[model samples]
Every structure is written in structure tokens, then in C-alpha cells.
Target: MDAPTVSRDFDVVVIGGGHAGAEAALAAARVGARTACVVIDPAAIGRMSCNPAIGGIAKGQLVREVDALGGAMGQVTDVAGIQFRMLNTRKGPAVRSPRAQCDRVVYNREMARRVVEAPGVEVVAGEAIELLVEPGASGGSRVRGVRLGDGSEVLAPAVVLTTGTFLGGRLFAGEWEEAGGRMGEAGAARLSRSLLALGLELGRHKTGTPPRLCRHSIDFDRLEVQLGDDPPQPFSFRTGRLDIEQLPCWITRTNAETHRIIARHADRSPMYRGRITGVGPRYCPSVEDKVMRFADRDAHLIFLEPEGRDLDDIYPNGISTSLPPEVQEEFVRTVPGLEGARILRHGYAVEYDFLKTHQIRADLQVAGVDGLYAAGQINGTSGYEEAAAQGLMAGANAARAAQGHGPFVLDRASSYIGVMIDDLCRVNPDEPYRMFTSRAEFRLLLRSDNADRRLTPIAEELGLVSAEDGERTGRKERRIRAAVERLRSVRQGERTLEELLRRPEVEIDDPAIAAALEELGLAADEASEVEAEVKYAGYVARQAAQVDRMRRLEARSIPAGFDAASIRGLSNEARDRIARRKPLTVGEASRLPGVTPADVQVLLAALSGGR
Candidate 1:
């Protein structure tokens, strides 16, 4: 006899328990939705499958934004961070970002704890093999829930799919290939068919990880040591201070011999041999790619990072590859300090299925499928921070959809989250999308130091944050405003203190400014915000005006039944693209690929009855 099918009900169901799913579940619960998170292995929740670190250039800004919105990633990072550093210290504040090397095991356990202990959230140990859908009253399919591998079903009004590199996943190391997502975890083999059945377009993307070496085997003395900042900064605004002892990472480089070995075995690589068909990230290419692409370069930097304070494994930050195990062994030995290193786990690449970003709306909901949403790597984005941000938005939106509310959407002028989602929705990436500071046009307004100032209000309005947290952010804002006004009034020679601070060379600690800051009694973080505002007042004003103009354009609505083909002077390609996209606003139509400024003008004319 067949096993009996068991059924359970939830307001929202989240599939996959990686960074994205954990945040999704937590966000759903925060929104008062009874959420169920399905995971193949309950112990692997929030697993850092690739790098054992969180936050980088543009990525740190994302983590801060997530935290500002009351997301758990920043808090968990603070609890588990072994080493914290602020990158790009000499650069402008817009590019400065915080990064933390985490205790991977602790990060997972802590995140899992938050998800499990959160009210209204249930952690289910099982693999989701199918999505339950029914015909909608509006003549389209809507997600009803998900079906598990063990003949059980979770019925919900909304579903969030945050399957990080697990759908149709295949791992490759040299000549060896396996059907798994990570080193030892089996892939979600049947979920791809379910997604395709709903008419969602899926594409392939590849990401790889470096080998883990036994810490004791590494000749640490031979490598140059890279230490955390003297006063390490935390990723979370809630973290008062970093109290734990920080660990040091070491750096080495792959020499000419290493490149030569990789080149000799290039044909053996799955990617080069045509076994892996997915497009990999351009910025974080594998070792073979680096060697082959940059043939003139003789060396590539590698950082040896500890997986945890007490663990025996150390991750080599570069040299990710899928060359056979023997070839991996050969090239790794050629690195200066790794000559005596023993590989605890060989480096490998995993190619997985992801939905094309264009198929999802800005709210992360599948375009035509009501109540179905996707986030993280499944949306063609790579990085834990990106995944976490998407998860938070997707979960919150799914909960709102269940409650019969409108979607919460962020815009490019507001936060990095808005920029990422906007970029994803407007264009389909040919390769995996990774966040970078350069990606934001208004990055100067989206600095990491002021994430709370930018997003906490939105979080509070959405009930994602506590009233106490909202009050705290308000106090910080008040202090910053008071400080800026005080600076404007205080005089230094003929100019005000604010004017002096704008000179770039004059810091807040300058004798004249320090006295004013002392009188204000602002905290370090608050003072920094004041400094940035005063220093870049002119640029900030310019950007704010630009934002206003963009918002005005966004406010101009496009009629649902408007005919794009009726517009004169529009290119044939632009008209066809606009008609098919059916953009809801003038601003969105302008952003679509191949839709030129001339096309937007014609669209505006048509909306104004000029055509």
C-alpha cells in the first residue's frame, strides 16, 4: 500500500533553509503570518556553503539594510563573527563597507535557533518536491502550498522559494561529477519540474568554492598575516561592541608554476570540457578562468581564512576550481605557503537552476503566479547578503499577499535593496548577479554608516521592527540633525564649522569641531553621520533633487489598456518591447532594456494624448 499523505496548513510556506529561507521565515512570522520552513537537513540551516564570511564592498551595505529592516543576518553575524574589518578605509564613505569572517558552525546554529524559536514559525525537516497550485478566479495559476518528499503536503495561501543552488544542482570537481548542491548535501531533484510547470523560465548559473585545508597542515609562518581592524566594527547596528577575541587571516599568492599547472589541465575542467553549461559570475571567476583570462598575470592573491575559532578547517579564499582532484592537489602545492597543506575538502563547482530575473516583479512575486515568490540564488543573485535581503522582502510580501494587502516595494533612491531588485526586474543577467557599490547610481545616499537612518522608518511602518527600535532610530536622527544645525551655527574664522568640515581634510575631531561635538554629546556612530551629512551637503542635495524628479516620473501612471504601438516616432523594437513588458509607470518603461529616452518621450506623449 502507498504511504498516506499528511496535510498541514500555514499562512506562508518557505522552501529551503539557507540564509534566504531563514530570513524569509523570520520576516513572515514578524508580519504575523503562521509560517512553515521546509529544509532537507534541519541542521544545515543558514549554512555558508561557499565563503565563511559575510559582507564585502556593496554587500556590507546590504547586510546593514537588512538589519535596519529588523532582519536577523546582521545580529547573527555579530554573534558569530571571528574577525571584523571595514574595507576601503581610505576611500569615500559611500564605498566603505564592513566585512566579518564568521564561525560558520556558530552562524548556522544561531540562525537556526532564531528561526526555530521565532513565534508563529515552524521548522519542518523534509525536502519540498512540488508546489501545489490551483486555477485562480482571475484565470491564472496561484500557489496553494508545497508537497514534501515523504508523501506529505503543506497548504498555505502563499509560498516562498529560496532554494539556494539546490534546484537541479550538480557538483563538479575535476573529472568527478555528482548530483548534489554542496559537498555532501543532495540536491532538490524534483523541484525544477514543479517550477517549470507554472511557466516560470529557468536558467543555469555556476558558482564554485575553494578547498578547505586542515589548519595544522598550513605553514602559517611563511604567509603574510592580515589582521582585523584595531577597533573592529560590527555588522549590526544593535551590536554594542565586539567583545570576542579576533582572529587573524593570512595571505599568499598563486605563482607562475600554479598557473602553468592549471593551464596544462584546463581541458580536464568540467567548464572547459563543456560538461557545465551555466554562466558563472564574471567578478568571481574560478582559478582556471583567472589564469586563462589574464594570461599576462603571473600571480593571484589568496587569503587563508579560518572557518571557526575552534575548528580545524581553513578556507582558501581564492583558487576556486573544478579541475580533477589530482590537478587540484598539484596546483595548490605550488602556492608559497600551501606547499605542505593537506586538503580537507577538494574545491569544486556547482551549477544550478535559477529563474530568470525578468520573470519576477519588483516585489519578488512571480509575475503571473499569485502568491508564489522566489529569492536568493534561485533569482540569479549570488551572496548571502543579497539572498538575505531578498528573503526578507519576499517573505514579508508573501505574508501581505496572504492578508490581502498590497505589496511593499522599495525604489532605487531609497536603499541598496531597492537598487538590486530594480536592476533584477529591469534586466535579465547573462551571469549570476552580485552586488557592488558601482551598481547603485545614488550610492552616496546609501552609505553603510546610515542604513538605519534610511530604512528603519520603512521597517517600523511595515511592523518589521519593534517600537523601541523605531524610537532609538528616531533619537539617532534627532541627534544628527541637531549636530548638523549646531555645526552650521558654529564659526571657524570667517566660515562656519560645517563649511570647514566640507574641505575633506578637516575631520570631526578638528579642535574647533571637537568642542561642538563634545557639547552635543553624540555617540561615535551619530557623530559620523553628522559629519557625512555636513561634508557632502551639496552632493546630497543634488541627489535628493534627482530623486524627486525620478519619483515624479514614477508617479505618472501608464494605463493598463494603452497601446504602445500607437506612439509615433518610437522605434519598432522599442514599441514591441514596451508593449510586451506592459510597464505600469513611465519610470519603469524608461528602465526596460532597449527602451530608449526617445521611446520614453513618445510614451509620455501618448499618455498625454499627443499621439
Candidate 2:
């Protein structure tokens, strides 16, 4: 498809200027491609609509990956954040996460400013109405450009659709409903219609956000205060240290009085009644739903979190509800900390149109469509972190696909990005999906602190990060290698690197390694990497061996056109999954929800054309 005028208007055009779009545009542009971002409303750029925070549990792992690959979430969050806390201090390194509360306004501005300043990136404010698909000689439609709301259009080889919750979005609270995507913004009326016309199958998903209370009005004296860790960790590897002063979050519990009050308004709740059609997230249940379902339970913990420093709003984390205004007011006053609390913003649930991600391939591209990628809330996922993670992966993969290469898929057992992509493309969810530590089977080797080590090589291969990022990671690796060798060589009363690390008492900043590493010409930062390597040596080695085994399966070709159903011994689940997911490799097939050991053996048989 040769262009008549200004051939190849841009290399990639990212729609929706949220986490995913930002990452997509940045990755494409960073890779030396002319990139453009089309956002519906520039005012909403990088808006932290639900929570004024980022990174939690496995979600923090993704943020570091974004930072390692030169995405801006971590760097921006670090600067604009008012509070920083490293969660799960008592837990192992794999489960540890860094969370922070930010001034939402500042976060949006900083993210926008960085993206606009990035080389080869352009920002446009408008709604993308339809995708332009030019046909190939073989006959499937190939994406050529996208049409905007104002009857204008731009051509690009690739288009990443990171449309968050704007597709047929409806907000509900009690019996009242609104037409906007969010309470304040308008929905994307044309985009979803165009998708349906393009034969894209879509599903409905819902997520509820709790109400914000005026912090000054709350009785903080009645609640316990939760503070951040003394020595905090930053989300991005590129960022040096997190030294932000922390804000205190209050904790209170809802008593039987609160439960009874909510119970009386159960029917008025949009969830219990037939008002809402989309499936709500199971983990973040609404207040009315919680009270009715957990009838035996006496109380539920509520975290009173500040929206940001000098802000009056305190977000009621555990009290998400869509109850009537009167009932909400009544139940709110019953909680210990919120006895005199006033609602700054009412809690409401959103029902938005999302693509059932099983329809998307591991690259985040549509199976039959060329250069069309979708990410974020549209992918049937919940939480800002989950959406941002998917957005970045989709953006990176779309850019790769446009370059005539295969999808940029990171294999599972190596990075959280791999686990997330695999899960989204394979598992069929009945509700909005959120990432939990329990979701990843191999999380022991994929800690948030070591994301740069896990993905720097692949990121370099993808041409997203500069050589400096890779060199930094490589130098760190050399330090680890040298220490590993030194440990192997020194086996006397003098402590080995690995042995010293195993003694939790021997710190990473110990003088012995610092002197030895200095003598070996390694920098202090590089020495720290060696320290982590020595500390987690046993677990890392075991995981690497497992990764090697998985790589074999990942490479074991399941032929492009293999038919699993015809195989004599294949189980129904295997056959159905094989037909549905069409996993590019046996490794991917194994990662699907229910393909058993026997199923793998049968799949191998089928891969040989069922001879």
C-alpha cells in the first residue's frame, strides 16, 4: 500500500493518551519511528481517575519493566508522589511492592510533559472514529490509518488502541445512572460501533471505586494511623533513590451497625438489583454486596487514605458502593473513623465495554487484523496498574509487528509481562481481571527489584531502551558473574559471596564485598546487583533451570495450522484451547488455564499431524 501523499504519515499512531498509549507512543518513538498519539481529551491525559496512586504487589514489577524499557510511569510517579511505601516488608523479595500516593493533577501534567518532549512523538487531541484498513492481495484487511471525530484522518502503518473505559461507558450509583465514560467525561460513541462493524467481539466488564471523604471532617483520633517504610524503594530502576516524605493513612473497621445499615439498602444497590449488566470485580466488592454475601462476618477493614499532600479528600478504600445517597450517608457515619465524615465524592460503579482478551493474541494484536492492537480497560482488566502494564506491552508489540517482525512476546518464567500477556490471551474471565501474586506460578524468580535484570536484554532486542540501559544491566551482570566465580573459588573460613548473602545479617553494604568489588573495578551500584544475585542465588538458579526447561517447550513448534481436535488422545479442554488460543508454541499451550501433562503429550502427537 504505497501512499500517494506524505507516504507513511507516521510509523505508529497511539489512540487514547492513558498509560498504554503513553507507553506505546514512547516505545515506537524511542525505537526511531515517527510516532503520534491521539487522545480523546487532552485534559484527561494520564488521569488517575480512580486512585491517586500506582504499583502494588506484582503490579510494581511491571512499572520497573516500563522504566527499564524507557517508559515514564516510574520516573513521573517518583517525582510527583507525596508519599512512598514499600509494601510486604515481612514477605520475600518476590512479593514486595512499592506504592505511593500522588497529587493526581501533578501526575497527569508531568506524564503529558514528558511524552510531548520525547523525540519523534506528536500529540493530537480528538476521538478516533474508525480504523482504516487497506486490503492485501491475499485479501485480509491491513490497517492503513484511522479517521478522527472531526472528519479528518491520518495514515500510519500501526495503530495501538489503548481506549480505557470510554466504550459505551455507563456510571451507576443506587438507582441513578449517567451517560459519560466517567462521571465528568463523555463516552466514545463511535469507536465501539466501528469495532463491532469490524467484527471485533466485545464483552461488558465493571469496576467500582470508593467514595472520597473530606479528610478534615474525619475523626482520625478514633482510627489507627499507617505510615510508610523508613527506607522506601522507587518503582523505576532508572531512578536512584526515593526520598519523599510520607503521608499517614488511617485505618478503621465497619461494625455491625454499618452492616445493618447497608443491608437495609441492599435492594437499592445497583449490583443486587437488575440495574447493572456488567460483571463487577470479585476482589473489590461493593459495600452492599459485601454485607449481603458475608453475612457471618462482623466487620471489614477500611483504609482512610489521603488523595495527596495538602488535599482535603481521604479515599475510603474498602467502602466501595452504589447505594442510594441517603443510605450511603447513613452507613458512612456509622464507621468509627468516619463518624462525622462528609462525602466529598460519591461511590459509583462503572459498566464499560471491554474486549474479552482471549480474542487477542499474545502480541495484543487482533488475530486476523494487521497493525491493530488493543490494551487497558478495554481488555477486560481492572486497576490502573494492570491497564498500564498491558498498555505498555501492547504498544511495544504493535511497534514490533509494524516493523515486519514477529510479536514481541516475553516468555513466562522470565518476566511478569510474560505472565500477564499469557493470562490475558488464554484465560477466559467471568469478571474484571486484576493481577495477584497468586496468579504467577513462578513469582519467586521475578521480583520487582530485579525487573531490569530480567527484561533488559529483550528490551534491547526490541530497540526500545538505549544501549546505555543494556550496558548498565550488563555491567551489573558482570559483577554478579565475578562474585559467583569468587564464591566458587573461595571455600575456606573466609566467607564466600553467596554464603555471606545467605546470612541475612550480612548486609549488601558490608565492607568486605565493597573492598573486594572495588579491587575488581566494579562500581557501588554494580556491587549491589551482585549482592542481590548472591542473596537470592539458590532460588535464582532453580528458577533459571526451570526457565531452560520451559524454553524447550516454548521452542517446540506446534505448527501454524495444527488441528488438535482430530488427535485421538487429546482431551476436550486441550482441543478447545488449541483451537481457540492457537498458541504459537507448546510452551504457550502449557501455560493456558487447564492443559494437563497428558494433554501436552497428546498435543505433541497432534503437532506431528496426528500420524
Model 1 error, position 278 (Å): 0.5
lDDT of 1 at 425: 88
The top-ranked prediction according to TM-score is 1
Candidate 2 segments whose C-alpha is farther than 4 A from its true place = 1-8, 136-140, 484-497, 500-536, 557-580, 590-611
How would you encode candidate 2's per-residue C-alpha lDDT over 70-144 as one tens digit per residue?
778998998778777877867666787778878787888888887788888888878888888877422456788
Output candidate 1 Cα RMSD.
Answer: 2.0
The candidate that wins on lDDT is: 1
Clashes of 1: 3
Over 4 Å off in model 1, which ranges? 1-4, 557-584, 598-611
Q: Model 1, range 251-296, lDDT digits (tens) per residue?
A: 9999999999999999999999999999999999999999999999
Clashes (N, CA, C under 3 Å) per candidate:
3, 0
Could you tell me every candidate's TM-score relative to the true structure? Answer: 0.96, 0.90
